[model samples]
Target: MLYLTINETNALLRTAHTDAFHLEVSDDHSAVADETEPMRRVLAGLPPFEPDAYPDSWREWDELVGEVTAHGVTMRRVRVVSEPLTDYVRFLQGLTDRNVRLGEDIRWLPRHLVDQADYTTDEWWLIDNARVAFTIFGTDGDFVGAALTEDPAIVDRCTGIRDALWRKATPHADYAPGG
Candidate 1:
């Protein structure tokens, strides 16, 4: 039940030896300062930046994903979104190809496809199937911190949820927003 700063969580994530899974449940994370300008550009109909010219934070994340995957650590993410597609989700969709190129498998699931009671509402990352880091966000969608836990029961439940959703979600290549 220990809470960790974002940096701490990143360090923990970098330690994953086998696999890492991310579950995103929020439609808007506008309060993330780094994404503000990029999201604005997306909303204005500007095309995404070329991969070599990505913003610093994005470049760093891309490098990390590349490095991890090159070492055989599998990285996957599932985003459960409500449609007609929030501008933020659309922005993420625009970035999906680059993410896949960097070696992460990304999927999109329409929220209505699953029973809400089947999973916790919090966003989380399961690292190496051994620990769960739950992201904590403010009411306005600002990420505050993360809570890391190794309690087997919680880990098992999250693992089950991730497996179920991953099977039902559409791969990014096949997902058509608002279709």
Candidate 2:
């Protein structure tokens, strides 16, 4: 099992060829440093974070998504969230349009509709159907590191999970976080 720093994972993402699918099971990644200020702003009822005001890493990510999508890579994310929405999930919901605008497909899956035993608990990014990068979060839900695996079994399982959940998830434009 090889581990990758966040930067390393980003680099790998930049190298993607066909598709990049992300599965997020956590309701809160608020402890992530880049998210703190935005989460606070959201909680305070401020308008969504402006693109120009995004954290440096986030801005870079947005750029990367735009670049990759322009080159024909399909990027998709499915977030499995519990409702009534957590503050952090609400925050993400507010910001999802920007991701969609950048050409990434984002979806939401209500937790109640999913059977826990049928899926992996960890959040992961499966790239080009070949590599899987599992995100590791601290106990407090802070971003830690990632484990990258190319083992066929792990990649296959993640692919299956992503496909099944994606079919059942609601597209960003159709998802109503508060409802």
Best by TM-score: 2
- Report the poorest 10 consecutive residues by lDDT, candidate 1: 45-54
Candidate 1: segments with Cα more than 4 A from true spot: 48-54, 138-140
Q: Tell me the tens digit of each residue's lDDT in model 1 across 78-152.
A: 999998998888888877887999999999999988776566688999999899999987686677779999999
Q: List the candidates' TM-scores in order.
A: 0.90, 0.91
Model 2 weakest lDDT span, ten residues long: 47-56
User: Where in model 2 is the C-alpha error above 4 Å?
Assistant: 48-53
RMSD of 1: 2.1
Mind giving the per-residue lDDT tens digits that candidate 2 earns over 64-142?
9988898899999999999999988988988888799998999999998886655778899999999999998878766
Global CA lDDT computed for model 2: 0.87
